[model samples]
Target: MNREFIKKLCEETHACVRILEGPIGTNDRIVLISAKEEPDLEISPAMDAFLRVFKHVNDISYGTGGSTDQIAAYFTACSVWLLVASQQAINLIGKQGSSIKSIQESTDATIRVISGA
Candidate 1:
């Protein structure tokens, strides 16, 4: 539920997460960044799946008041799925270049928007 705990979980799972705490009356933000340089177009689809899962996780963590362990477990599952999706995207792309880099950034930006990062 707290920043440090979620951060630790993210690190253990090798996921890139940036938690931003806002000013008074503002809610904290959780951002997931891509570690890959040239992921495929499939990355967008993977991100779509991640967003859906994230919504459920958010509901459980903020709405239902799940335990720390439960949240941790759900996050772990999400992280694993994200990693697999990233890997799959990379595998599908297979090479790096200016075009691939452009696509990667585009996809990353799309993910950031969708994830509210």
Candidate 2:
């Protein structure tokens, strides 16, 4: 994995991530800034995928106990993961007209694989 890339993401978003802790569940469970760190800033699907990844609203979570910037940074980091996740989906699509659900599942599988889930 690209440690620097993840670190850069956290730096820009002002958050930190501990890979060993890993995602709570789902092959593509995204905490956005990720649950990797306690987000302290506002996070959206553009900047994260908590809601996007989790179909259940009550299941998607955002941090509530840290600096706003920290939360933003954390989301930013998760955004980075989302970025990577998107890339994976794109790759899975390749030249084939793949189904959206299939692409999502493929990318989600990749996220957990890369995140040490």
Candidate 2: what lDDT?
A: 0.43
lDDT of 1 by residue, 12-97 (tens): 43445554554468674444544333355434433433443465556554443334454555543433223235545555455654
Q: lDDT of all predictions, in order shown?
A: 0.44, 0.43
Candidate 2 collision pairs: 13-73, 33-74, 33-75, 39-71, 40-68, 40-71, 41-71, 41-72
Residue 104 Cα positional deviation in candidate 1, in Å, after optimal superposition: 23
TM-score of each: 0.28, 0.23
Instruction: Please identify model 2 stretches exceeding 4 Å from their true place.
Output: 21-117
lDDT of 2 by residue, 49-96 (tens): 333222223332344433334344433233334435755756645555
Question: Lowest lDDT 10-mer window, candidate 1?
Answer: 108-117
Error of 2 at 48 (Å): 4.5
Provide the RMSD of all predictions against the true structure, rounded to 1 decimal: 12.6, 14.7
- Candidate 1 regions off by >4 Å? 1-14, 30-32, 38-41, 44-53, 60-117
Shift of residue 100 alpha carbon in model 2, Å: 22
